[model samples]
Target chain A: MSDRATLSTVAARAGVSPSTASLAFAGSPRVAPATVERVLRAAGELGYAGPDPIAASLRRGRSGVVGAVIGERLLYAFRDPVAVQMLDGLTEVLGELGVGLLLLAGDGGPAPAQLGRLPLDAAVFATCGLEDDPAFRLLRARRVPLVAVEGPVVAGVPLVDIEDRQGTVELAAHLRELGHRRVAMVTMPLRLDGRRGPVDADRLATGVYRDTRERLLGAREVFADLPAVETASNGIEEGEQAGAALLSGPDRPTAILAQSDLLAAGVLRAAAARGLAVPGDLSVAGFDGADLPWLAPVRLTTVVQPTAEKGRAAGRAVVALLAGEVPPDVVFPVVLRPGTTTGPAPA
Target chain B: MSDRATLSTVAARAGVSPSTASLAFAGSPRVAPATVERVLRAAGELGYAGPDPIAASLRRGRSGVVGAVIGERLLYAFRDPVAVQMLDGLTEVLGELGVGLLLLAGDGGPAPAQLGRLPLDAAVFATCGLEDDPAFRLLRARRVPLVAVEGPVVAGVPLVDIEDRQGTVELAAHLRELGHRRVAMVTMPLRLDGRRGPVDADRLATGVYRDTRERLLGAREVFADLPAVETASNGIEEGEQAGAALLSGPDRPTAILAQSDLLAAGVLRAAAARGLAVPGDLSVAGFDGADLPWLAPVRLTTVVQPTAEKGRAAGRAVVALLAGEVPPDVVFPVVLRPGTTTGPAPA
Candidate 1:
């Protein structure tokens, strides 16, 4: 490592000033092409590589890396199409900005102790309900610009959120319009700890996950006595379990509203297992209009939130925060996409 | 910014040595409790946060970040279950090691110019056939430790590769044993450029992507005159298009072997579009035993690679390389999972 050559050595070998050498390596037009060639030749002779990133970052006061704090484990998070699409959009913006994405997995609060040493210009809390996250506290202590995608919004940190409540309300109303009086719900985790099973009234009213709480509230407005089962995670298997619990009973609901498309897919699977025809025996509606191409022939009736756009919005907020400008909190709209899965309630 | 408190200032205010002040911040047990408390009070008074990450990195000579270069867009890459599963595995290891994952999207060759300024201690060429990748050259020039997940296995860089040829040969044999005389292949991209259309003999012999080429060769060993269609991307839609192109022709084969399960799903969709029954009209086989829950009841007959294990092996190699130890290249085995998609050809 000591044998490694520096820009100064290259400059000295080229008989050029250090600044000129730097300019040549940076591809600056100020340096003459012939002089650049000479510097390159010297660099080749001395086995000097390009400018070191550490030195460059020190000079610029920027790490050229943005940390994306994912709340859940990578295995579970990557399984969700909504999360994947959002991440894809965020990567698009960050990639175009020339900054690499540094994934930081957080469990609700502040990052792990290991992240204490990482140099991040800004951090995006991609998961929801992070107000109590210890990682968040640590990042705040580091004075890095922070952006939240959903909830527990922190002061001074700009937020990019979706209208989660409105989407559920519309879907529930659509079901009500079809004369579905008995409806059961499958919900996202009430908190980051992944508590599952029958959700009581008190838990529903005081849940930590803002998106889940808000969506549940919206659904309650339509069906005042709608019972819900919270899942351990937003996955098809969990959805299936929740669906089985709800549909196996003697008094089954005519319609089921799931928080995500993947969960709705699970519900569909449970229905199939019981030999129940969709929209005939049960009507299932899901949120997050994810393109489940494999779930063919049965397009889900869902509220289409702009998943990618939400991510891009978060990316924009990050850019703004980095530029020393405060970005306003954003709340994207959601639309109801009627598909073959939902229809008039069975007489 | 200029008035921000330093460790020296806190030390001076606390009337303690700077070394003690540093130890207090680092939570070192060497410092007396009273001295640590004094240093903390001084730090609080001065409004000093923890030590700066950039400064710490410069002192330690490690960025605490590892770059994983994916040679494709995140959107397209995330669509493939195999890629997602592998990434999930890699992240699990890196997380335990206390290093943040820096996602670097590469376009087959060099990284974008912006990436040159990003600080990375080591780089993983996680994508395939990156011998000529510009980013690879840059990382090598920077003296960063390198790990490859697959081919173009560099001389010193330890590689983690799967037995790409064996699985395909086994699957093709299974198809042949079913008395299938005619077979059509839907292959992954022969190159990163995603050229889709009829695949000829010369193109097959001189393909750039090693995995695609090896799989093609494996299939050819059984069906010497096997015709194929190459897809532009490793996506269900691309597979669907390729499938439609092959299955819609006048002289359709008795069986179609897709290079990936996602593509096989597309072939299934195409079959559904044409009202063809599986194993009755056409027997389909696929590679990469991914869990396609949405493709329910029609379990795919495919080759199952240990995707997660492959990623973990690469991660281990990275750990070894960073520790100044040379690790041997690893080749993981594949298994043939016979599912409902393939059976005896129609009589």
Candidate 2:
């Protein structure tokens, strides 16, 4: 190739053995730092992209890949503060352990079509709303050790979950105690099969995602007969749309319980658009108590789950599994964090 | 070690040659798919993480590491939407090609202490933030093929840049067209040295980062005397803080131009806090045109840069450089998009 040089040529130019050049490329701590530096300088002068890993991988039959199986391709899944925070926490743990994350997004993470052929040492299941995703089924087929985060309680797969149901119950009770009788809820997807319209009684039973199912039940357990709507994804816009649709009619709810902070935010925006006051005219609560500091003085009354703890638990489980120890599935507790978005029911 | 099984051992247990087992792992198009299925079924029974990549890396002299050098901690860098989107796009492209990414985030990439010790074939310079990052100096000394993204414009290192200056200028002109002369600005960090606060006439002379300097000049060219408040990072909260401070004092500009969409979101929040109706009371604009469907109805009047194109260009550059070609520096174009956030100056 015109201006480019291969590792062999770089080594030849540096007057070192090809093995030495290889050592330089690996950044092997064992190599004398000076010699590695010299090889790199020579390689740079020769216009090489260090070593071609594709060629090496063909021979070695291994690629340092850790797949992150995400359920959908919605843009918010990546930018949602809560999702990003959880990912950051997980990445912190995995990166320290010398692992890199391959975000295998949409349709069971990086193409369910290549169930067995994908190069991954292990796979972690990451999804936003609690929905029936095929991440478990596909990774299972590949024999990849599975670590599910905030999803169904799948057998044989280790899990990292939060106390989502209990947290919602506490939030609903809190809203009721604040003088709210006519309450409503904005729930996550009720079942798989990618349903996005109005949720019904039968769909609730067939809910595939554990968290969404539990949270909805928790809300019902609190208010007995609370009005509620379901959104396609956990997003502010979806929440706002749901809020608008629910609140548009004459017999509207006084308080709204959203499964996620983004949904709650949308509800707040909807209320604002309709000239309703947050606490004076309406009350709203959210889950995944993330810091929406930009929401300013209007804080969100919600549940705070330990995201980093979830990541650490997953990491510990991976380490244990690798060490041949059966790691028990972990369920981290959630705390009721009341903020300013909620108050007395509408007068 | 422990439960980790190498491909050779799996091959032995399956009573097949290591190469055959490797072929099974590859699932090559030429290989009989049935043979591939059987080899996998056997490998599954042996309790293997497929192949011990750490061991294979040592033996093969190449690690499938396309190390991306980020200027801050992984958490901080990963939080930014722009960085995350670029990473998402880059990974999407590389994943299809079986190239794994190692997000090596720290001042410039990895520290000098880590430069010679990472298993990277070629390193991509990610968000190094236009300073004399020690990481780049070390990568230079070590001769790692540096591919800078929206960073320093080193002579030899291949750069992947978006039209930041042009984009901002177009945005500023749109504001100008709307009859807004007293426009305020919020910018990304002016220097990699962390000397953040305000970039006045004096600081502009000693500006360090090429991208920052270019973007500032591009905006300045439109409104040369316009004063811009410098933010510590390109985040929403920071933008909100900047907006609150700027909008509070004397003669807050009718239009505020933010360098990033996240920051623009913050500014919108700040405006909301003050009961300022967007477009009705204040005209606002931003860059990077991030997906803001969540901030819907009030679509952002911003510039849209080709994010996926930039990532694809970087991927293609790496491929070409690997194939021994002089990959040219790529600077993608931008388009000015008008939305609900901007309107004619209030009467």
Top lDDT: which candidate number?
1
For model 1, residues B1-347, the per-residue Cα lDDT tens digits are 56778789999999998888988989999889999999999988887876778877877778888888887877677778887777777777777788888888763112467776788888787765545777777777767888988777678888889888888889999999999989989999887776899889777766767788888889998899799999998888888899999988888999999999999999988888889999789989888898777777778999999988887887788888878899998999999999998888888
Docking class of 2: incorrect
Docking class of 1: acceptable
In candidate 2, which residue pairs clash?
A: A301-A339
TM agreement with the true structure for every prediction: 0.95, 0.80
lDDT of 1 at A303: 95
Worst 10 residues of 1 chain B by lDDT: B106-115
Specify the highest-DockQ model's number.
1
- The CA lDDT at A269 in model 2 is 91
Give the Å error, residue A132, model 1. 1.4
Q: Candidate 2 on A1-347: residue-level lDDT in tens?
A: 47457788999988899999998888789888889888988987887756554455444543445666666652446656766666666666666555555566663123455434445567777664444455566567556777888765678878888888888889989988888888888887665354565567877777777788788889989988776788877778888889998789778888989888888999999999999988788898899877665466678888999876676677667656655677888889999988888888867
Per-residue lDDT of A233-315 in model 1, one digit per residue for the tens?
88899899899999998789999999999899999999989888998999999999998887877899999999999889988
